[model samples]
Target: MAGGMPDRNFLVNVFQLVDKDRSGAIDSRELQSALSNGNWMPFNPDTVRLMIGMFDKKGSGTITFEEFGALWKYVTDWQQCFRSFDRDNSGNISKEELKTALTTFGYRFSDKFYDVLMRRFDRSGKGVIYFDDFIQCCIVLHTLTPEFRQLDRDQTGTATFTYEQFLLVLAKILH
Candidate 1:
Protein backbone atom coordinates (compact mmCIF):
# COMPACT_ATOMS: atom_id res chain seq x y z
CA MET A 1 0.00 0.00 0.00
CA ALA A 2 3.03 2.22 0.40
CA GLY A 3 3.10 4.20 -2.83
CA GLY A 4 6.82 4.88 -2.23
CA MET A 5 6.83 8.60 -2.94
CA PRO A 6 10.04 10.48 -2.17
CA ASP A 7 11.17 11.25 1.35
CA ARG A 8 9.32 13.49 3.77
CA ASN A 9 10.72 16.81 2.55
CA PHE A 10 9.57 16.04 -0.98
CA LEU A 11 5.97 15.97 0.20
CA VAL A 12 5.89 19.75 0.25
CA ASN A 13 7.23 19.88 -3.31
CA VAL A 14 4.28 17.80 -4.46
CA PHE A 15 1.93 19.98 -2.44
CA GLN A 16 3.30 23.23 -3.84
CA LEU A 17 3.20 21.85 -7.36
CA VAL A 18 -0.48 20.91 -7.14
CA ASP A 19 -1.53 23.70 -4.81
CA LYS A 20 -2.27 25.80 -7.90
CA ASP A 21 -4.12 28.15 -5.58
CA ARG A 22 -1.51 27.70 -2.85
CA SER A 23 -4.14 25.83 -0.89
CA GLY A 24 -3.06 22.53 0.67
CA ALA A 25 -5.08 19.47 -0.41
CA ILE A 26 -5.93 18.27 -3.96
CA ASP A 27 -9.37 17.07 -5.06
CA SER A 28 -10.00 14.07 -7.37
CA ARG A 29 -11.02 15.86 -10.60
CA GLU A 30 -8.18 18.29 -10.20
CA LEU A 31 -6.04 15.22 -10.01
CA GLN A 32 -7.67 13.78 -13.11
CA SER A 33 -7.40 16.99 -15.06
CA ALA A 34 -3.84 17.52 -13.93
CA LEU A 35 -2.99 14.04 -15.05
CA SER A 36 -4.80 14.53 -18.31
CA ASN A 37 -3.05 17.83 -18.72
CA GLY A 38 0.11 18.55 -16.81
CA ASN A 39 0.25 22.09 -15.45
CA TRP A 40 3.35 22.92 -17.49
CA MET A 41 2.87 20.16 -20.02
CA PRO A 42 0.24 18.31 -22.05
CA PHE A 43 -1.88 15.31 -21.06
CA ASN A 44 -1.46 11.74 -22.26
CA PRO A 45 -3.90 8.86 -22.29
CA ASP A 46 -1.24 6.37 -21.25
CA THR A 47 -0.23 8.51 -18.32
CA VAL A 48 -3.85 8.85 -17.28
CA ARG A 49 -4.43 5.12 -17.46
CA LEU A 50 -1.34 4.45 -15.40
CA MET A 51 -2.47 6.97 -12.84
CA ILE A 52 -5.98 5.61 -12.47
CA GLY A 53 -4.48 2.20 -11.84
CA MET A 54 -2.22 3.61 -9.17
CA PHE A 55 -4.87 5.41 -7.13
CA ASP A 56 -7.97 3.38 -7.82
CA LYS A 57 -7.83 1.45 -4.53
CA LYS A 58 -11.50 0.54 -4.14
CA GLY A 59 -11.71 -0.74 -7.72
CA SER A 60 -15.00 1.12 -7.79
CA GLY A 61 -13.79 3.28 -10.69
CA THR A 62 -12.95 5.98 -8.18
CA ILE A 63 -10.48 6.69 -5.44
CA THR A 64 -11.69 6.50 -1.85
CA PHE A 65 -10.40 8.10 1.37
CA GLU A 66 -8.66 5.01 2.63
CA GLU A 67 -6.96 4.60 -0.76
CA PHE A 68 -5.65 8.13 -0.48
CA GLY A 69 -4.32 7.44 3.04
CA ALA A 70 -2.21 4.59 1.72
CA LEU A 71 -0.41 7.07 -0.52
CA TRP A 72 0.14 9.54 2.35
CA LYS A 73 2.24 6.97 4.16
CA TYR A 74 4.60 6.96 1.19
CA VAL A 75 6.04 10.46 1.46
CA THR A 76 5.37 11.31 5.09
CA ASP A 77 4.65 10.17 8.54
CA TRP A 78 0.92 10.83 8.97
CA GLN A 79 1.44 12.84 12.12
CA GLN A 80 3.54 15.45 10.33
CA CYS A 81 1.19 15.73 7.34
CA PHE A 82 -1.74 16.15 9.73
CA ARG A 83 0.00 18.93 11.62
CA SER A 84 0.54 21.04 8.49
CA PHE A 85 -2.96 20.65 7.05
CA ASP A 86 -4.42 21.45 10.43
CA ARG A 87 -4.84 25.00 8.84
CA ASP A 88 -5.53 26.81 12.09
CA ASN A 89 -2.63 24.52 12.94
CA SER A 90 -5.32 23.10 15.21
CA GLY A 91 -4.41 19.50 14.47
CA ASN A 92 -7.04 19.26 11.69
CA ILE A 93 -7.92 20.80 8.32
CA SER A 94 -11.43 22.27 8.32
CA LYS A 95 -13.90 21.43 5.57
CA GLU A 96 -13.70 24.93 4.12
CA GLU A 97 -9.93 24.74 4.12
CA LEU A 98 -10.07 21.27 2.67
CA LYS A 99 -12.43 22.46 -0.05
CA THR A 100 -10.13 25.37 -0.67
CA ALA A 101 -7.26 22.99 -1.25
CA LEU A 102 -9.23 20.85 -3.67
CA THR A 103 -10.69 23.84 -5.43
CA THR A 104 -7.25 25.27 -5.90
CA PHE A 105 -6.39 22.20 -7.94
CA GLY A 106 -9.82 21.44 -9.41
CA TYR A 107 -11.04 24.89 -10.47
CA ARG A 108 -10.67 23.75 -14.09
CA PHE A 109 -12.95 20.77 -13.60
CA SER A 110 -16.72 20.48 -13.69
CA ASP A 111 -18.74 21.39 -10.60
CA LYS A 112 -20.05 17.85 -10.27
CA PHE A 113 -16.64 16.16 -10.49
CA TYR A 114 -15.17 18.61 -8.04
CA ASP A 115 -17.93 17.81 -5.58
CA VAL A 116 -17.25 14.10 -5.78
CA LEU A 117 -13.51 14.55 -5.46
CA MET A 118 -13.90 16.54 -2.25
CA ARG A 119 -16.48 14.21 -0.72
CA ARG A 120 -14.27 11.23 -1.50
CA PHE A 121 -11.15 12.74 0.02
CA ASP A 122 -12.78 14.32 3.06
CA ARG A 123 -14.31 11.10 4.32
CA SER A 124 -14.59 11.82 8.04
CA GLY A 125 -16.92 14.75 7.38
CA LYS A 126 -15.13 16.55 10.18
CA GLY A 127 -15.12 19.52 7.78
CA VAL A 128 -11.33 19.49 7.88
CA ILE A 129 -8.51 17.08 6.97
CA TYR A 130 -4.95 16.27 7.93
CA PHE A 131 -2.34 16.13 5.16
CA ASP A 132 -1.67 12.52 6.00
CA ASP A 133 -5.36 11.84 5.53
CA PHE A 134 -5.32 13.18 1.97
CA ILE A 135 -2.52 11.26 0.29
CA GLN A 136 -4.46 9.88 -2.65
CA CYS A 137 -5.83 13.34 -3.32
CA CYS A 138 -2.33 14.79 -3.63
CA ILE A 139 -0.74 11.93 -5.52
CA VAL A 140 -3.44 11.94 -8.14
CA LEU A 141 -2.24 15.40 -9.11
CA HIS A 142 1.53 14.86 -8.84
CA THR A 143 3.39 15.39 -12.11
CA LEU A 144 6.39 13.42 -10.95
CA THR A 145 4.33 10.81 -9.14
CA PRO A 146 4.44 8.10 -11.80
CA GLU A 147 8.21 8.28 -11.96
CA PHE A 148 8.32 8.17 -8.21
CA ARG A 149 6.42 4.91 -8.32
CA GLN A 150 8.63 3.49 -11.04
CA LEU A 151 11.66 4.26 -8.92
CA ASP A 152 10.19 2.32 -6.04
CA ARG A 153 9.26 -0.67 -8.15
CA ASP A 154 12.06 -2.83 -6.87
CA GLN A 155 9.48 -5.52 -6.46
CA THR A 156 8.82 -6.21 -10.15
CA GLY A 157 12.29 -5.14 -11.19
CA THR A 158 14.96 -2.83 -9.84
CA ALA A 159 13.87 -0.05 -12.15
CA THR A 160 15.22 2.97 -10.41
CA PHE A 161 13.94 6.32 -11.66
CA THR A 162 16.77 8.40 -13.02
CA TYR A 163 17.04 11.69 -14.81
CA GLU A 164 16.41 9.71 -17.96
CA GLN A 165 13.10 8.52 -16.67
CA PHE A 166 12.17 12.03 -15.68
CA LEU A 167 13.08 13.27 -19.12
CA LEU A 168 11.09 10.53 -20.78
CA VAL A 169 8.04 11.29 -18.72
CA LEU A 170 8.37 15.00 -19.28
CA ALA A 171 8.77 14.45 -22.99
CA LYS A 172 5.54 12.52 -23.16
CA ILE A 173 3.59 15.17 -21.30
CA LEU A 174 5.35 18.23 -22.59
CA HIS A 175 5.35 17.26 -26.24
Candidate 2:
Protein backbone atom coordinates (compact mmCIF):
# COMPACT_ATOMS: atom_id res chain seq x y z
CA MET A 1 0.00 0.00 0.00
CA ALA A 2 2.82 2.37 -0.71
CA GLY A 3 2.45 5.60 -2.68
CA GLY A 4 -1.18 6.19 -1.65
CA MET A 5 -2.41 2.86 -2.98
CA PRO A 6 -5.26 1.27 -1.08
CA ASP A 7 -4.25 -1.04 1.69
CA ARG A 8 -4.81 -4.77 1.51
CA ASN A 9 -7.80 -4.61 3.83
CA PHE A 10 -9.51 -2.05 1.65
CA LEU A 11 -8.91 -4.13 -1.46
CA VAL A 12 -10.35 -7.17 0.27
CA ASN A 13 -13.46 -5.26 1.21
CA VAL A 14 -13.93 -4.07 -2.35
CA PHE A 15 -13.41 -7.55 -3.72
CA GLN A 16 -15.91 -8.98 -1.32
CA LEU A 17 -18.48 -6.35 -2.25
CA VAL A 18 -18.01 -7.03 -5.93
CA ASP A 19 -18.14 -10.79 -5.59
CA LYS A 20 -21.87 -10.78 -4.95
CA ASP A 21 -22.28 -14.50 -5.45
CA ARG A 22 -19.58 -15.25 -2.89
CA SER A 23 -17.85 -17.55 -5.33
CA GLY A 24 -14.49 -16.18 -4.22
CA ALA A 25 -13.97 -14.63 -7.62
CA ILE A 26 -15.18 -11.72 -9.66
CA ASP A 27 -16.68 -12.60 -13.02
CA SER A 28 -17.15 -10.30 -15.98
CA ARG A 29 -20.63 -9.23 -14.96
CA GLU A 30 -19.56 -8.50 -11.43
CA LEU A 31 -16.57 -6.50 -12.60
CA GLN A 32 -18.57 -4.61 -15.18
CA SER A 33 -21.16 -3.62 -12.63
CA ALA A 34 -18.53 -2.56 -10.17
CA LEU A 35 -16.60 -0.41 -12.64
CA SER A 36 -17.68 2.87 -14.17
CA ASN A 37 -16.43 4.71 -17.20
CA GLY A 38 -15.53 8.39 -17.38
CA ASN A 39 -19.17 9.13 -18.09
CA TRP A 40 -20.39 7.04 -15.13
CA MET A 41 -21.65 4.31 -17.41
CA PRO A 42 -21.17 0.65 -16.62
CA PHE A 43 -18.06 -0.82 -18.16
CA ASN A 44 -18.47 -2.53 -21.50
CA PRO A 45 -18.86 -6.29 -21.18
CA ASP A 46 -16.22 -6.96 -23.80
CA THR A 47 -13.67 -4.83 -21.99
CA VAL A 48 -14.43 -6.59 -18.74
CA ARG A 49 -13.96 -9.95 -20.40
CA LEU A 50 -10.70 -8.83 -21.91
CA MET A 51 -9.33 -7.75 -18.58
CA ILE A 52 -10.43 -10.98 -16.97
CA GLY A 53 -8.65 -12.90 -19.68
CA MET A 54 -5.49 -10.91 -19.07
CA PHE A 55 -5.37 -11.44 -15.32
CA ASP A 56 -7.24 -14.68 -14.64
CA LYS A 57 -4.12 -16.70 -13.84
CA LYS A 58 -6.12 -19.81 -13.02
CA GLY A 59 -7.88 -19.71 -16.37
CA SER A 60 -11.21 -19.64 -14.54
CA GLY A 61 -12.56 -16.64 -16.48
CA THR A 62 -12.85 -14.81 -13.18
CA ILE A 63 -10.52 -12.76 -11.02
CA THR A 64 -9.79 -13.94 -7.51
CA PHE A 65 -8.82 -11.67 -4.64
CA GLU A 66 -5.16 -12.47 -5.28
CA GLU A 67 -5.48 -11.03 -8.78
CA PHE A 68 -7.62 -8.01 -7.85
CA GLY A 69 -4.69 -5.75 -7.12
CA ALA A 70 -3.20 -6.13 -10.55
CA LEU A 71 -6.57 -5.69 -12.22
CA TRP A 72 -7.23 -2.56 -10.18
CA LYS A 73 -3.89 -1.10 -11.18
CA TYR A 74 -4.49 -1.88 -14.81
CA VAL A 75 -7.82 -0.03 -14.81
CA THR A 76 -6.46 2.98 -12.97
CA ASP A 77 -3.51 3.24 -15.33
CA TRP A 78 -5.84 3.20 -18.31
CA GLN A 79 -8.04 5.82 -16.64
CA GLN A 80 -5.06 8.14 -16.28
CA CYS A 81 -4.05 7.55 -19.89
CA PHE A 82 -7.58 8.22 -21.12
CA ARG A 83 -7.75 11.46 -19.18
CA SER A 84 -4.45 12.69 -20.56
CA PHE A 85 -5.49 12.15 -24.18
CA ASP A 86 -9.08 13.31 -23.73
CA ARG A 87 -8.02 16.96 -23.83
CA ASP A 88 -11.58 18.19 -24.24
CA ASN A 89 -12.84 16.44 -21.07
CA SER A 90 -15.91 15.37 -22.95
CA GLY A 91 -15.63 11.82 -21.58
CA ASN A 92 -14.88 10.56 -25.05
CA ILE A 93 -11.86 10.35 -27.34
CA SER A 94 -12.14 11.87 -30.77
CA LYS A 95 -10.28 10.54 -33.76
CA GLU A 96 -7.71 13.31 -33.52
CA GLU A 97 -7.15 12.64 -29.85
CA LEU A 98 -6.72 8.94 -30.59
CA LYS A 99 -4.18 9.74 -33.27
CA THR A 100 -2.21 11.84 -30.80
CA ALA A 101 -2.32 9.06 -28.24
CA LEU A 102 -1.12 6.51 -30.79
CA THR A 103 1.68 8.80 -31.92
CA THR A 104 2.71 9.40 -28.33
CA PHE A 105 2.87 5.64 -27.89
CA GLY A 106 5.14 5.37 -30.99
CA TYR A 107 2.57 3.91 -33.32
CA ARG A 108 3.00 5.18 -36.84
CA PHE A 109 -0.24 4.45 -38.61
CA SER A 110 -1.89 5.85 -41.69
CA ASP A 111 -5.03 8.00 -41.81
CA LYS A 112 -6.99 5.05 -43.10
CA PHE A 113 -5.95 3.02 -40.10
CA TYR A 114 -7.23 5.66 -37.76
CA ASP A 115 -10.51 5.81 -39.67
CA VAL A 116 -10.91 2.07 -39.45
CA LEU A 117 -10.08 2.08 -35.74
CA MET A 118 -12.68 4.70 -34.96
CA ARG A 119 -15.31 2.90 -36.96
CA ARG A 120 -14.60 -0.43 -35.34
CA PHE A 121 -14.43 0.82 -31.75
CA ASP A 122 -17.21 3.36 -31.80
CA ARG A 123 -19.75 0.94 -30.39
CA SER A 124 -22.22 3.72 -29.74
CA GLY A 125 -22.01 4.93 -33.33
CA LYS A 126 -21.33 8.41 -31.98
CA GLY A 127 -18.19 9.09 -34.01
CA VAL A 128 -16.27 9.20 -30.73
CA ILE A 129 -14.82 6.55 -28.44
CA TYR A 130 -16.12 6.03 -24.96
CA PHE A 131 -13.85 4.90 -22.16
CA ASP A 132 -14.58 1.20 -22.43
CA ASP A 133 -14.21 1.13 -26.19
CA PHE A 134 -11.03 3.19 -25.98
CA ILE A 135 -9.57 0.73 -23.51
CA GLN A 136 -10.51 -2.20 -25.69
CA CYS A 137 -9.02 -0.58 -28.79
CA CYS A 138 -5.75 0.30 -27.10
CA ILE A 139 -5.46 -3.15 -25.54
CA VAL A 140 -5.87 -4.82 -28.93
CA LEU A 141 -3.20 -2.62 -30.49
CA HIS A 142 -0.84 -3.07 -27.54
CA THR A 143 -1.28 -6.82 -27.60
CA LEU A 144 -0.85 -7.20 -31.35
CA THR A 145 2.04 -4.84 -32.06
CA PRO A 146 4.73 -7.10 -30.58
CA GLU A 147 3.40 -10.06 -32.50
CA PHE A 148 3.37 -8.05 -35.69
CA ARG A 149 6.93 -6.91 -35.12
CA GLN A 150 8.01 -10.48 -34.58
CA LEU A 151 6.49 -11.47 -37.90
CA ASP A 152 7.97 -8.47 -39.69
CA ARG A 153 11.50 -9.48 -38.74
CA ASP A 154 13.13 -7.13 -41.26
CA GLN A 155 10.93 -4.24 -40.18
CA THR A 156 10.06 -3.53 -43.82
CA GLY A 157 6.47 -2.70 -42.81
CA THR A 158 5.20 -5.99 -44.22
CA ALA A 159 5.00 -9.68 -43.41
CA THR A 160 4.36 -12.64 -45.64
CA PHE A 161 2.43 -15.57 -44.20
CA THR A 162 0.47 -18.47 -45.60
CA TYR A 163 -3.23 -18.80 -44.73
CA GLU A 164 -2.50 -21.33 -42.02
CA GLN A 165 0.27 -19.20 -40.55
CA PHE A 166 -1.99 -16.16 -40.51
CA LEU A 167 -4.70 -18.11 -38.72
CA LEU A 168 -2.22 -19.33 -36.18
CA VAL A 169 -1.09 -15.80 -35.44
CA LEU A 170 -4.64 -14.61 -34.92
CA ALA A 171 -5.45 -17.61 -32.79
CA LYS A 172 -2.44 -17.07 -30.61
CA ILE A 173 -3.18 -13.41 -30.05
CA LEU A 174 -6.89 -13.80 -29.53
CA HIS A 175 -6.45 -16.70 -27.17
lDDT score for residue 61 of model 1: 47
TM-score of each: 0.30, 0.92
Off by over 4 Å in 2: 1-5, 172-175
Q: Which candidate is the best by lDDT?
A: 2
Q: What is the C-alpha lDDT of each candidate?
A: 0.50, 0.87
Model 2 / residue 133 / CA error / Å: 0.7
User: Who wins the TM-score comparison?
Assistant: 2
User: Candidate 2's error at 35, in angstroms?
Assistant: 1.4
In the range 40-77, model 2's lDDT, one tens digit per residue, is 66788878888999999999999999999889878888
